[model samples]
Target: MSKEVAAQFDELAALYEDMASWPFRHDIETPSVIAALGDLHGLDVLDFGCGSGLYSRLLKRSGARSVVGYDLADGMLGYARRRAEKEGLDIEFVSELQPRFAGRFDVVLSVYVLPYATSVRELGEMCGALAGLLRPGGRLVALPIHPDYQPDPDYYQAYGFRLIPDDDHDRPPRSDGARIRLELCHGRYQASVHAWYWSRATLEAALREAGMTDLVWRDPSTASDPAAAAPLLRAYLDRPHAALILARKA
Candidate 1:
């Protein structure tokens, strides 16, 4: 992680737990991520880019034999550690991937993390790391910001959040793309953060280079159970928000 990016997360660490519960995450992203990663019983799972170990706890509760959460931010890791201790959940949270972890997990889950790759090379490196951590036949499921995502005014109004481009530019001219400011107000708390965007082709190429195959672009609606995620599904169908990537290590 770049110093700038890491600093941003460090500052947001305290607010992240609440932010993680944003309707889009709890209602949409989480369900999609879980559905894409079906049947965790006795599986060794890793929550890549896990912030505050939210999904790590979920994976443990869902019956993963062992769950490890990895992230670059110390503040987030601190929160994760405290949460795990308080909840009495046996989860290992680490800031770096140890050598012993290579080829050890049955599944790797990443939600809303890929876009942090500011460049194509960086994106490929991240993908390579994910592939390295998974054993042969191990699956990777990730939910990244959609490449074609454009903020809709109505959707923002309905969702109680706001997405504002850094500038008036419709698209970024540089290879790294532009940043967008995301602001959310839930009850008395309010928070804002900047997020990057990358092209879909760039992501696909990175996955291929990482030796992952059978890449499938899943529709967000199909990524979750309809009955349980009706509002999220409806919102996704109304306007595409995030993209689900399912790939396997060969």
Candidate 2:
């Protein structure tokens, strides 16, 4: 991660946990990712870019044998460690991945992590790293900014967020690695982060180059148990800002 990107995450650490509970994340993101992950029982999982340990905790709760949460920001790592300690979960939170840990997990889950790669090579490295952590045949489930996300910046505002081109120029981002701004609008707090855009072709090429195969892209689904916002999610679900990607290290 770049110093600037790491700094942005550090700055957002204070609001990260609260942001995790917003409808966009809790009701939409979590469920879709969890579904893509399927049964985690007995799986050794790695939660890459696991800010605040949200998905790490969920992976354990869903019966993963072990979970390791990795992130670049110290503040986020500290918050994640505190949460794990307080919750008495044995998950490990680390700011770096050592060489000794390569190919150690049965499943690798990365939520909203890919967009941080601002260049094609960076994107390849990110995907390569994720692939390296997985045991042969292990699953890699990720959430990247949807390749077909709604163009209008305010289209997803009802779900507490918006994605606008950084330059306010092209709507779908005319090219790969285009910069974009993601705004989080919620009752607890408001925040924004910078991310890059990658089309399905670009993302697939990167993953395939990293020895990953069997790509499946899924749209975010609303909570199945009739969440209060269930009625308000038709549009976003149809044109969600994020997508769940399932693949395997071959």
Candidate 3:
């Protein structure tokens, strides 16, 4: 993905909450994560890839001592800071990923960030940065766009409304009938194409290469139940939502 498209999200930041409607809450997947993370009271927390600070607000209500919001998009961070100020919630907004976090946070929440990474090396570096910043025993809880959902064109537009998925990379031909659409929709009449499909094994391998362990994968309930899929598409189209990956720094 281009940095240009990443910039688009920031532009949409101000109206994101309203445009999403009330039920489009990112916290739809947050509660289960927090529960698995255990205690939050008085613990310092970081909302990595914090978008519009919705989860940051949720963290405050859950009793975190201090919650800092970080994101790559300035527009999102702008909204976060404004929301913090208006609500009398003190949240430190870091507009870009720094070499290291200045203070130790007990919990780090990285939701829907990995898929946007440009490469496997980039993903590894991100994990390394998080690992280096975490306090010993502090957990790094993240939700990755399941490689399964990579084929959907809507996923590409979500990253940048104008961009299309690149399919020039070489890969082996599939022996099965599995396929995912990369439909690019623009308003009611305009639409185009984008690349679709990433394998589950590749995703797991990336995590392993990043040195992440204690891996536990939970398919989001809203995404679709694992047992509900036919065997052919089970690895890719079986899940449509986020994949909860709880990995330890060590």
Candidate 4:
């Protein structure tokens, strides 16, 4: 299933620019994240699962001292390399993992990679490796599926998962009243993998277990907007969407 997902993205490289920068819609949550990140001056960043190098370029333009992007898709990497070249940006594209990168970065950003992990164990390993790559006091920012939008079909298919409206940051649980459609990309190869959702409590627990603390969770901008409906929030949360999580290395 993992291999097939990568293959699909490898084939998607040619169309990635259009898909990523499309005016009306896009699969990845680039705008939500970039807005959340704010500024990146003098930061040394490692972009984990940086597809098509969109965020990588943004980081450089934000004045990052150095930016390196890693991804499983060659097609994305090719476009990334070319874009970097044409723009004269000195971003590094590493297609494979390197031991030397351990503890080398001031910040690590994983935009949309967590859902691909088939299990919690795998997710732990992925997070652990990313944590190991961070320097002490360095930050790691990630976007994952909001747990409210994700319910186990085996358990919640009857009621379609709990839905409740929320407005507060910590006081309110995820706005569950909305019905969001999550389109699993590699459904043909793998039984449709929706979302391995995790609540704020669940996320904090996992990060603490990995020896990370000071976790900060923020709602996607679209979610906080009073104008957005529950279903749209759910769509923003589930679709190639991202939950911005920031934590520091202890």
Best-fitting candidate, scored by TM-score: 2
Model 3's C-alpha root-mean-square deviation from the true structure amounts to 6.3
- Misplaced by over 4 Å in model 2 are 168-174, 223-229
Candidate 3 residue-wise lDDT, 18-131, digit = tens: 533322123234445656666789988888878798878778878999888888788888888898899998788886555557438788888766655555566566666666
lDDT assessment of candidate 4: 0.64
Instruction: Evaluate model 1: give its TM-score.
Output: 0.87
Strongest candidate by lDDT: 2
lDDT of 2 by residue, 19-112 (tens): 7677667777778888889999998999999888888999999999999999998888988998899999999998778696799999999988
- lDDT per residue for candidate 1 within 1-250, as digits (tens), equals 4546755676556566776676666676677678889999999999998887888999999999999999887888888999999999999999878697999999999887887776677788889999999999999998777766656534664455666666456675222456666676667657776666766788888999999999998856644456665674476555666789999999
For each candidate, what is the lDDT? 0.78, 0.86, 0.59, 0.64
Clashing residue pairs found in predicted model 1: none
Regions of model 1 farther than 4 Å from truth:
167-176, 222-233
Q: Each model's TM-score, in the order given?
A: 0.87, 0.93, 0.70, 0.71
Q: Report the Cα lDDT for residue 211, model 3.
A: 58
